[model samples]
Target: MSIKPAIFLPELLRHLFKRPVTVKYPFEKEPVPKDFRGNVVFDPPKCIGCMICVNDCPAEAIEIIRVSETEKKFKMLLHNDRCIHCAQCVDSCPTKAYHMDSEYEIAAFSRRHLKIEYK
Candidate 1:
C-alpha cells in the first residue's frame, strides 16, 4: 500500500536549511516597534494632578496622593503589577502628561519594585 506524503515536507526542509529565526537574548538587544506598549511614563510638570489619570485608568494602576493642597501638586504613583497596558490613562490625560514607552523587559521577582513614584 502507498501512503500520502506530508504537506509540510517542503516547508520543513526550507526552514531546516535556513538560518535560525531567533537571536540570543542579553547578547543581542532587539529594537522595539514604534507603537509597542511596554510601560507608562508620567511627566510630573505637565500633569496638573487633577486625578484624571487615576480615575480613568481601567486597571486602577495610577494613584494621585494629595501631599499638600496648598502646593497644588500631587504625587503621581504607578503600580506596574496592577497595570494591564490598556493605555487608558494615556488617552484620558487632558494635558498629554502621560505617555507609553517602549521598554517591556522589566522582569523582576519582587512586586514592590514595580511600583514607581514620578515626582
Candidate 2:
C-alpha cells in the first residue's frame, strides 16, 4: 500500500488562504431578525394582571400573586432552562404588557443565572 497522503494536500492548501467561517461572537453581535422570537419583557404600567399570559404560557414561566384586594402583583419568572422561546406569552397578553425582546445572547455558566424575575 502507498504511504503518501495526497488527498489532504488540496484541502490544506485551500483552507490556508480562505477567511475564517466562524464569527467572533463575544466581540461582534449580529442583529436579531424581525421575526425572531427572543427573551420576554414585561411592562408593569400597561399590565392589568389579568393572568392571561400566565394561563397561556406552555412553559409556566409566569406567576401572578395577589398582594391585596386593591392590587394584584404580577411576577414573571422566566426560567431560560425551561423556556421554549415560542413567544406565546407575548401573544396572550391582552394589555400588551409582554413583548419579545431582540437580546438573544443568553448563554450562562449556571442554570441559576438563566432565571429572570420580573415583578
Top candidate by lDDT = 1
Q: Name model 1 segments beyond 4 Å from true.
A: 1-19
TM-scores of the candidates in the order shown: 0.79, 0.71
Which stretches in model 2 have alpha-carbon errors above 4 Å?
A: 1-22
lDDT of 2 by residue, 4-113 (tens): 56877888899999999998887999777898888888777677778887888898777765545866655566777778888898888888888888887888999999
| Cα error, candidate 1, residue 103 (Å) | 0.7
lDDT of 1 by residue, 4-118 (tens): 4576688888899899988878788889888889889988778677787888888889988767767766678899999999999989999998899999798779999999898
List clash counts for every candidate, in order.
Answer: 0, 0
TM-score of predicted model 2? 0.71
- Per-candidate Cα lDDT values, in order, are 0.85, 0.79
